[model samples]
Target: MSRTTFTLDDLKRILLEGSGVPEGADLRADILDTDFTDIGYDSLALLETASRVEREYGIELDETVLGDATTPRAFVDAVGAHLSAQPV
Candidate 1:
Protein backbone atom coordinates (compact mmCIF):
# COMPACT_ATOMS: atom_id res chain seq x y z
CA MET A 1 0.00 0.00 0.00
CA SER A 2 1.14 3.54 -0.70
CA ARG A 3 -0.02 7.00 0.11
CA THR A 4 -1.80 8.95 -2.58
CA THR A 5 -1.62 12.26 -0.83
CA PHE A 6 0.78 14.03 1.49
CA THR A 7 -0.49 15.85 4.50
CA LEU A 8 0.90 18.09 7.22
CA ASP A 9 0.37 15.41 9.83
CA ASP A 10 2.43 13.03 7.72
CA LEU A 11 5.26 15.54 7.50
CA LYS A 12 5.07 16.19 11.24
CA ARG A 13 5.37 12.49 12.02
CA ILE A 14 8.29 11.99 9.65
CA LEU A 15 10.05 15.06 10.99
CA LEU A 16 9.63 13.85 14.52
CA GLU A 17 10.87 10.38 13.69
CA GLY A 18 13.70 11.14 11.25
CA SER A 19 14.96 14.20 13.10
CA GLY A 20 13.57 14.84 16.51
CA VAL A 21 11.69 18.03 16.77
CA PRO A 22 13.82 20.81 18.13
CA GLU A 23 13.06 22.22 21.56
CA GLY A 24 10.59 25.11 21.36
CA ALA A 25 9.57 24.04 17.87
CA ASP A 26 5.88 23.41 18.11
CA LEU A 27 4.68 20.85 15.62
CA ARG A 28 1.23 21.20 17.19
CA ALA A 29 0.82 24.70 15.84
CA ASP A 30 -0.42 25.56 12.36
CA ILE A 31 2.98 25.37 10.70
CA LEU A 32 2.06 24.58 7.13
CA ASP A 33 3.06 28.00 5.89
CA THR A 34 5.98 28.43 8.26
CA ASP A 35 9.43 28.03 6.85
CA PHE A 36 11.24 24.90 7.99
CA THR A 37 14.17 27.06 9.07
CA ASP A 38 11.88 29.15 11.23
CA ILE A 39 10.70 25.95 12.89
CA GLY A 40 14.21 24.79 13.72
CA TYR A 41 14.58 22.42 10.76
CA ASP A 42 17.62 23.26 8.67
CA SER A 43 18.42 22.13 5.16
CA LEU A 44 20.01 19.00 6.54
CA ALA A 45 16.96 18.13 8.54
CA LEU A 46 14.77 18.71 5.53
CA LEU A 47 17.02 16.47 3.50
CA GLU A 48 16.67 13.74 6.06
CA THR A 49 12.96 14.23 6.09
CA ALA A 50 12.90 13.96 2.32
CA SER A 51 14.90 10.75 2.43
CA ARG A 52 12.58 9.23 4.97
CA VAL A 53 9.58 10.22 2.96
CA GLU A 54 11.07 8.78 -0.20
CA ARG A 55 11.89 5.44 1.37
CA GLU A 56 8.61 5.21 3.20
CA TYR A 57 6.57 6.16 0.17
CA GLY A 58 8.77 4.41 -2.35
CA ILE A 59 9.07 7.51 -4.45
CA GLU A 60 11.99 9.55 -5.62
CA LEU A 61 11.62 13.23 -4.99
CA ASP A 62 12.89 15.82 -7.39
CA GLU A 63 15.82 17.54 -5.69
CA THR A 64 15.16 20.78 -7.49
CA VAL A 65 11.56 20.76 -6.33
CA LEU A 66 12.62 19.82 -2.85
CA GLY A 67 15.13 22.65 -2.83
CA ASP A 68 12.41 25.07 -3.79
CA ALA A 69 10.08 23.85 -1.08
CA THR A 70 10.95 26.08 1.84
CA THR A 71 7.79 25.65 3.90
CA PRO A 72 5.80 22.67 5.09
CA ARG A 73 2.96 23.58 2.74
CA ALA A 74 5.29 23.65 -0.22
CA PHE A 75 6.92 20.39 0.78
CA VAL A 76 3.60 18.71 1.33
CA ASP A 77 2.34 20.01 -1.99
CA ALA A 78 5.42 18.76 -3.76
CA VAL A 79 5.07 15.32 -2.26
CA GLY A 80 1.39 15.29 -3.01
CA ALA A 81 2.12 16.06 -6.62
CA HIS A 82 4.53 13.18 -6.86
CA LEU A 83 2.20 10.85 -5.09
CA SER A 84 -0.57 11.85 -7.40
CA ALA A 85 1.56 11.01 -10.38
CA GLN A 86 2.40 7.54 -9.15
CA PRO A 87 0.75 4.52 -10.71
CA VAL A 88 -2.19 3.41 -8.69
Candidate 2:
Protein backbone atom coordinates (compact mmCIF):
# COMPACT_ATOMS: atom_id res chain seq x y z
CA MET A 1 0.00 0.00 0.00
CA SER A 2 1.11 3.52 -0.72
CA ARG A 3 0.71 6.58 1.43
CA THR A 4 -1.55 9.37 0.28
CA THR A 5 -0.78 12.98 0.94
CA PHE A 6 -2.89 14.74 3.56
CA THR A 7 -3.28 18.37 4.37
CA LEU A 8 -3.64 19.82 7.85
CA ASP A 9 -7.41 19.95 7.43
CA ASP A 10 -7.40 16.33 6.35
CA LEU A 11 -5.31 15.36 9.34
CA LYS A 12 -7.56 17.34 11.66
CA ARG A 13 -10.64 15.66 10.27
CA ILE A 14 -9.09 12.25 10.80
CA LEU A 15 -8.03 13.09 14.35
CA LEU A 16 -11.37 14.66 15.24
CA GLU A 17 -13.33 11.77 13.81
CA GLY A 18 -11.10 9.16 15.39
CA SER A 19 -11.21 10.91 18.76
CA GLY A 20 -15.03 11.11 18.69
CA VAL A 21 -15.05 14.85 18.57
CA PRO A 22 -17.63 16.57 16.37
CA GLU A 23 -16.57 17.46 12.85
CA GLY A 24 -17.18 21.11 13.60
CA ALA A 25 -15.31 21.13 16.88
CA ASP A 26 -12.65 23.81 17.13
CA LEU A 27 -9.50 21.70 17.14
CA ARG A 28 -7.29 24.46 18.42
CA ALA A 29 -9.72 25.34 21.15
CA ASP A 30 -10.19 21.71 22.02
CA ILE A 31 -6.47 21.16 22.41
CA LEU A 32 -5.88 24.41 24.22
CA ASP A 33 -8.67 23.76 26.67
CA THR A 34 -7.73 20.24 27.61
CA ASP A 35 -5.50 19.14 30.47
CA PHE A 36 -3.24 16.40 29.12
CA THR A 37 -3.00 14.57 32.44
CA ASP A 38 -6.79 14.47 32.73
CA ILE A 39 -7.86 14.42 29.09
CA GLY A 40 -9.73 11.18 29.80
CA TYR A 41 -8.41 9.27 26.81
CA ASP A 42 -7.53 5.77 27.83
CA SER A 43 -4.55 3.86 26.45
CA LEU A 44 -6.90 1.92 24.23
CA ALA A 45 -8.41 5.10 22.90
CA LEU A 46 -5.00 6.50 22.03
CA LEU A 47 -4.00 3.26 20.38
CA GLU A 48 -7.23 3.25 18.41
CA THR A 49 -6.72 6.81 17.26
CA ALA A 50 -3.11 6.13 16.31
CA SER A 51 -4.07 3.03 14.42
CA ARG A 52 -6.80 4.91 12.62
CA VAL A 53 -4.29 7.52 11.53
CA GLU A 54 -1.81 4.89 10.37
CA ARG A 55 -4.50 3.11 8.41
CA GLU A 56 -5.83 6.30 6.89
CA TYR A 57 -2.44 7.54 5.73
CA GLY A 58 -0.83 4.18 5.11
CA ILE A 59 2.20 4.92 7.22
CA GLU A 60 3.57 3.38 10.37
CA LEU A 61 4.23 6.25 12.73
CA ASP A 62 7.54 6.43 14.55
CA GLU A 63 7.55 5.66 18.25
CA THR A 64 9.55 8.80 18.96
CA VAL A 65 6.89 10.95 17.38
CA LEU A 66 4.16 9.06 19.13
CA GLY A 67 5.86 9.52 22.48
CA ASP A 68 5.95 13.29 22.15
CA ALA A 69 2.27 13.57 21.43
CA THR A 70 0.87 14.60 24.80
CA THR A 71 -1.76 16.90 23.38
CA PRO A 72 -4.12 17.09 20.42
CA ARG A 73 -1.90 19.66 18.71
CA ALA A 74 1.09 17.40 19.17
CA PHE A 75 -0.78 14.56 17.58
CA VAL A 76 -1.86 16.73 14.70
CA ASP A 77 1.59 18.11 14.17
CA ALA A 78 3.26 14.72 14.32
CA VAL A 79 0.80 13.22 11.86
CA GLY A 80 1.17 16.19 9.58
CA ALA A 81 4.92 15.72 9.58
CA HIS A 82 4.54 12.07 8.74
CA LEU A 83 2.16 12.90 5.90
CA SER A 84 4.51 15.52 4.56
CA ALA A 85 7.47 13.16 4.68
CA GLN A 86 5.71 10.29 2.96
CA PRO A 87 6.65 9.30 -0.55
CA VAL A 88 4.80 11.00 -3.33
Per-residue lDDT of 1-88 in model 1, one digit per residue for the tens? 3677779999999999989989899999999899899999988899999999998898999988668999999999999999999988
| Predicted structure with the largest TM-score when compared to the true one | 1
Candidate 1 residue-wise lDDT at 27: 92
Candidate 2 backbone collisions, by pair = none
Which residue runs does candidate 1 get wrong by more than 4 Å?
none
Model 1: worst 10 consecutive residues (lDDT sum): 1-10
lDDT of residue 6 for candidate 2: 46
Over 34-78, each residue of candidate 2 has an lDDT whose tens digit, in order, gives 534455554565677788778867888887755677766677678
> Which candidate leads in lDDT?
1
